[model samples]
Target: MSEQLVEALRGAVGDGHVLTDPDVVEAYAVDWSRRFRGPVLAVVRPADTAEVAAVVSACVTAGVPVLAQGGNTGLVGGSVPGADSAPTVILSTRRLTRLDPVAELAGQVTAGAGVVLADLHRHVRAAGWEYGVDLAARESATVGGTVGTNAGGIRVCCHGMTRAQVVGVEAVLPDGSVISHLGGLPKDNTGYDLTGLLVGSEGTLGVVTAARLRLVRPATGSAVALVGVCDAADALDLVRSSVPRGVRLLAAEIMDAGMLRHVCDVASVPWPLPQQHDHVLLLETESPADGDVAMDLPDDRDVVVALDAADKARFWSYRERAAEATAVLGVPHRFDVSVPMGSWDAFVSDMRARLRGIDEVEEVLVFGHLADGNLHVEVLGPEPEDERADVVVLAAVADHSGSISAEHGVGRAKAAYLALTRSPAEIATMRAIKAALDPHGLFNPGALLPSGPASPSRSS
Candidate 1:
């Protein structure tokens, strides 16, 4: 069966595009965090949507599961196959790099799933527009992967998540049928929003081949400020009081002192502030012609504002280089969760105390978009397979009336604990949708959905 499937894949895409060698397949089998890996019969790279449809058709006929991978930069185990998955073929989207010219009149662009986020940013910026989604992994993260997870980045507070930017999508469903809606219409009022449904489905519904993304006008004269704060609550208060009356708030980020120090050491950059406090708040605001927005901030606490572009980049490096620095400490159990605004500080305090109590938790680093109440938690000192830390952290999130998964999709990491955030009825509806779209379960099985009965609800 493996031989026949390989032959079919080779026929759909060229022989050279289908890789069966163990040495080469290893790179595509594992995820970015080096946590999840599985065996693959072969890796097939398709060039266009038609080719992707053909490949999916072949795999469906062969009774083999297909895992669609795009940049493979996902921290969760969604983009890659699992260790116990059946003989699967990784449908690589790296070759589907069709980027259409920017629709200047509509302020949108249609890009293939394989198009890197950084490249899209450059392409749209050249047309006097911005993509709005900016993250550290922009250089390697692909459009389809970001769309698959509905990624929220630093600019989410300003421009909203990927779902808002996505106007249309072109995908190949589990039955090998193509759905193309790349018109970029502003008002469709269509029956069942298929694009929105697939945006955060995590590849369980279908493989996103291309997307029509809405672009935003570039910000004019921005100023960045790094201020010291006592805690998350203090940071939130500072964000409200610091910005001037007319200045527009673009971003608000918060990080612990320990995490900031680690990032500074790993990046080999000088500390931006004079005195470090327990937590630091980074704010980016729109400036006027004079570019003196930082002058309006209160002088009570330590503040370092960057008016020039170079200085702003330097200040942002501390926040952007955080994930890279955490990776240096080895594979850390990473969790991206969100709590309510009122309970943000208390959740952080409670979560930190709970994590410290764990014997396997050696170090805990916390940082995230402060205004949005999303926190990225990285825990070190646990083996990759040890899930004790997962239970402790996710359970605490449920206890605080928070979501188990925030910007990042459930993937296989938090699928079981999904019931903690979602009710049984919601999970059943998701399953019904899954059955309607993918009855054979060929598109990304064992992801975004729990395998067994939903766990009892724990949310307050």
Candidate 2:
């Protein structure tokens, strides 16, 4: 059966595009965080929407689970196969790199799923526009992957999430039917928005082939400032008080002293501020004039602002290099969650004390977009397979009335804990939608939705 499925995939997408070698397929089987991995019969690369539909159709007929992967940069296990013994094939969308011309008047562009985020940024910037979303993995993160996760980055407070920027999408349904609506309409009173449904579905409902994305005008001039704060509350207050009245706040990020020190040591760069503080708040705003933007800020606290492009980039490195630094230490159990503003400080304090009690926890690093309550928690020393730390962290989030996931979707990593954030009825509704779109349960099974008993015919 595996041989026949491989032959069918080779027929749908060309023979050369199908990879069966263990060495080659291994890379596609693992995820970005290196925590989840599973076996696959073959890896199929589809170049266009037609090929993707054909690949899905073939897999559906053969009763083989199809996992649609774009760049394979997902931190959760959604983009990769699971540990189940069910026969699976990974459909790679790296070759679907079709980028259309930017529509200057409409402020939009259509990009294939395989187009990298960084490349799309450059493409629009050349046209005097910018995409709202920005991430540290921009160079490798693909359009489809970001859409699948509905990624929110530093600019989310200003431009909103990936769902806000996505005007339309082209996707292949579970049964291999293709649905496309890339018109980029400003207001479409369409019924049951399939584009919105697929934006953050985590590939369970369908495979996102391309997206018509909304673009924003580029800022004329920007200034970045790094301010030292005693804690999260002080940082929040400073953000409200500081910055000129007319200037628009572009981004507000926060990092703890421990996380900063680790980033500096790993990146081998000096701390931007003169003295160390418990936490640092990085703010970027549109500059009203040419002179230093930091000068306008009250001189009551330690503040370092950068107007020069090079200095600004250097200052941003401490926050941007955080994930890279954590990866260097080893594979850490990563959690991207959101807590309420009022309970933010208390939640962090509670988590710090709880996680430290665990013997295996070597270090806990916390940082995220301060304007929003999203926090990226990285814990070292727990084995990749260990879920003890996960329980402690996610439980704390639930106790604080916070969500289990913020930007990263509830892939296999957090699927089991979906109940902590979502109600039983909500989960049931989601399951019904999954069943309707994928009755056979062949598209990305065991992701986003929790696992249940396998059916007689299909093993999810």
Candidate 2 lands at a TM-score of 0.96
Task: Name the top TM-score candidate.
Answer: 1
Give the TM-scores of the predictions, in the order they appear: 0.97, 0.96
Off-target runs (Cα >4 Å) in candidate 1 are 454-456
Q: Where's the lowest-lDDT run of ten residues in candidate 2?
A: 451-460
Q: How many residue pairs clash in each candidate?
A: 0, 0
- The residue-by-residue lDDT of candidate 1 on 248-352, one tens digit each, is 778999999889989989988877789868888899987664366743678678998886788889889999999889888899999999999967778877878
How displaced is residue 222 in candidate 2, in Å? Answer: 0.4
Error of 2 at 55 (Å): 0.2
Instruction: Tell me model 1's lDDT, rounded to 2 decimals.
Output: 0.89
Measured with C-alpha atoms, the lDDT of residue 328 in candidate 2 is 87
Q: CA lDDT, every prediction? A: 0.89, 0.88
